[model samples]
Target: MWTYQHSDFLVHQIPALENNYIYVVADKHSDNVLVIDPALAELVRDACKQLNITPSHILNTHHHWDHTDGNAQLVAWYGCEVVGNAADTKRIPHISKTIHAGESFDIGSLHIQSLDATGHTIGHIVYVIDDALFCGDTLFGAGCGRLFEGSFAQMWTTLQSLAALDEQTKIYCAHEYTLANLSFANSVDGNNPELQARIIKDTQTRNMKLPTIPSSIGLEKHTNPMLRALDDDFCSAYNPGKTPLEVFTDIRSKRNVW
Candidate 1:
């Protein structure tokens, strides 16, 4: 487990089921806590016990089993309200509150706003609270999720929306894929100094057994290949005059086989 403290919230990153991350966000001033994508009930429950903060809510980004497998158990144990996209209400177990894009919710004094990120899944959404973005599979450190439900254009639009946030915003994506993603990024953008530096830095961090998460939006803009799909150098491998969405689709196809 790794922990990060922000101005109004404390975030705990609990690794579960291979590379997946289950986040526990707690109010800094009170016992109010919100668990994000509790994939493993035991790990989340034990972490809550150690932190001395009981979860009052569970926020889901999508309907994937790995993201919602613990919902029923956690709701049964803690009676926490399960909040997810209304479009995925039937898929999210024990759902108590169905939210839509642009809606805002609260945990203590922290205000959380939801963004429609429906490329990885039809109901996939990312939550923004203060300076932190709790993005599920929509965005990764240097990669994006596979287009399992939405179109390439939809995913590109979603990425554009997230990229428009403050450059300093911390992205809390749901996987430990920085190293692998950066390797692929290096293969595509080998001439980028920032991407090379990030690869070295992330290698050291992983070697030290540290979490390489909570990457900043500024850093991703400089290194993430998916976000750089429209860059001239990045699109050089494809045909000229390709639209951003077309370039993005080509890059995604290459990554699928990479």
Candidate 2:
């Protein structure tokens, strides 16, 4: 588990069920603890138990089983409210409250904002709490999610919005896919100095069996091919003469096969 402390809340990144990470966020000012994208109940249950916390909510980024399979079990144990995208209420199990994109809400002292991220799956949404982004699979380190149920255009727009966030923002995506993503990124943008450094650094992190997640938006903007796909120079280097969206589409297509 990776723990991040803030003035008003505590975040615990719990690795479970292969690559998935379940985040347990405890608000310092209230009894409201939130579990985000829990892939299994035991890990989260154990973490909360150790922290002496009773979760007040289960927050899902999408209705995918890998992200929500433990929702029912957690809810049964804690009777916590489940929050997700309003359009996905029917899909997200045991959803109790619906939130829309651009909407802001408070969970105790933790201020939260929602962003529509529908490329990984339709109705997929990401949460922002302070500078930490629980993006599920919408965005990944060095890459982005596949267009599973959304169009390339939709996913492109979503990436644009997320890339525009504060550079200091920390990304808490759901999976451990950085190494493979870096491999693909190197194939397309191998000469990038920042990416080369990141590959070496993240390689060491993984070699030590530590998580390489919680990558900063600033680092990603400088290294991730998907985010860099927005740059004209990147487009010229890879898919010459293509527009930003065109470059993004080309990268996604190549990544799909890679």
Candidate 3:
């Protein structure tokens, strides 16, 4: 388990189901607890026990089984209100509140805004809480999710929106794919010194059996090749003559078989 101690909340990242991370956030001011992507009930239950919290809400980023498998059990245990994309209500188990992109909601004193992230799946939405982003399977540390049920354009648009966020924003994505993603990033953007440094740092972190998540948007924008698909200089250097969308498509296609 890894914990990010915030001034207003304590964000607990519980490792489960191989690389999946189940997040339990405890609001310090209002004492409100929330769980994001509770992949397994037992893991979430134990984390909540350690924190002495009964989560009042559950936030689901999408309808994938890995993200929603524990929703029913947690809702039964805590009688929590489950929140997810409005279009995913039918698929997200026990979902009680549906929100659309750009919608803001309050979980006690915590303010959360949803952003459309429909690449991995239709109706996928990521939550923005303060400076922390719980982006489940949409944006990885150095890569983006595969276009399972969305177009390259949709996924590129989503990535562009996230890249435009505050540089200091902390990305609390759901999986531990930093090392692998960095390998792919280096394959395409090998000349980037920042990407080289990230590969080394994340490799060391993994060697220590630590979570290499909660990557800053600044770090990702500088090191993630996928995010650079639209950069004019980047395109001119690596994929000259390709339009922004074409560049994005080429990157995603190459990553599919990487």
CA lDDT of 163 in candidate 1? 90
Give the higher-TM-score candidate: 1 or 2.
Answer: 2
TM-score per candidate: 0.96, 0.98, 0.98
Stretches of candidate 2 exceeding 4 Å from the true structure:
none
Top-down lDDT ranking: 2, 1, 3
Candidate 3 on 93-124: residue-level lDDT in tens? 98899899779999888999999988888999
The TM-score measured for candidate 3 stands at 0.98
Give me the displacement of residue 183 in model 2, in angstroms.
0.6
For residues 1-258, what per-residue lDDT tens digits would candidate 2 score against the true structure? Answer: 889987788889999888888999999899999999989998989888888889899999999999999899989998989999899989999999999977889888889999999898899999999988999999999989998899988999999999999999999999999999999999989999999999999999999999998898999989998988777788887777788888888889999999
Query: Residue 247 lDDT in model 2?
Result: 84
Against the reference, the lDDT scores of all candidates come to: 0.90, 0.91, 0.89
Measured with C-alpha atoms, the lDDT of residue 112 in candidate 3 is: 90
Candidate achieving the largest lDDT? 2
Candidate 3: worst-modelled 10 consecutive residues by lDDT: 222-231
Per-residue CA lDDT of model 1 for 72-182, tens digit only, reads: 899999999999999998999999999998789876787999999989988899999999999999999999999998998999999989999999999999899999898
Cα error, residue 101 of model 3, in Å, equals: 1.7
Model 2 residue pairs with clashes: none
Which of the two, 1 or 3, has more TM-score? Answer: 3
